[model samples]
Target: MATEWLGLHFLFGAFLIGAVLSRGAGEHLPRTATQETRQVTLILLLPAYFLLAGLRVDLSALDPSGFGELALVLVVAIAAKTASAFAAARLHRLGSRDLAVLATLMNTRGLTELIVLTVGVETGILDGNLYSMMVIMALVTTAMAGPVLSGLLRPAGGGEQPFSGETAAHDEPLPARHAREETG
Candidate 1:
């Protein structure tokens, strides 16, 4: 709400603060304070966040007359995200398989997108039909991530387990430098 006064999304403000504070993972806090914070997040914040997201998207609010527009939005959202991620991964010299994996994952409208969409609806930036279309696009793209990435990242011979870290691809941990790069 305070951020809205400055014409910034509240989530973006929260994200900026979190990014700065998370740099040291709250080393200034006592261990019990850290543990309690995690507990509160898990026990209260997580469920509330998801519940808010779920409640904001009412499927019946979708306009039957807007099917064509919805279809176009979904197609463009998925295609644009995948193509951009694929191009970026290729530029990074990722392997062909990894490129596909990156593209598939990039298309997902995860919690961050959901939060923004909910905020849009709350702030009247989105009307019923438009919000419905956006929500549908987000749902469809996110739903595709697991199955699509599984197929894209699978190893040869197809015997490896799907999403189990014990698979051949996960046989060895990533190098420390690579892990650091990924985390950063």
Candidate 2:
């Protein structure tokens, strides 16, 4: 209601509401509840949103002359995002595997990118061809995150466990004891 009244994008309004709600109630939420919410959001809402975005894409608007521009955008976007994440991870003294995972995750464009592109198109900041290119770039970069992280964080040998001790190699999924301590 507030979103429509203010002429705000639905995604932006939803994000704002989520941020506020999380700030107010996140810690009180049970871990399993949070996990279930995330799983449902990913499995249901995300695919429908992306599919809608894809359907809106005007494939006929793609110009052959724009191929170079598209490639440039893709390269620059990926490089800039990954490089920034890598630098930040390095500054934090994270391990090589941790750095790779951080960078790959940070580089993912996902739904946020689609939301931005949608706004851009609606506002006349981007035409059909540019929007198409950016959408493709988002999809490619998001898709790369999983494979890249898996390759980077895979166990060094068949005998090695993926995680060990109080300080695992990756930054995500904090050691169980550490997580409990933090939560408490």
> Top model by lDDT, which number?
2
Give the clash count for each candidate.
0, 0
* Per-prediction TM-score to the true structure, in the order listed: 0.75, 0.70
Tens-place lDDT per residue, model 1, 30-144, is 9899899899999999889878777666667556657778889988998899899988866655656666777888877567677788778878898767776787788889998
Deviation from native of the Cα of residue 61 in model 1, angstroms? 3.8
TM-score of 1: 0.75
What is the alpha-carbon lDDT of model 2 when measured against the actual structure?
A: 0.77
Against the reference, the lDDT scores of all candidates come to 0.74, 0.77
In candidate 2, which residue pairs clash? none
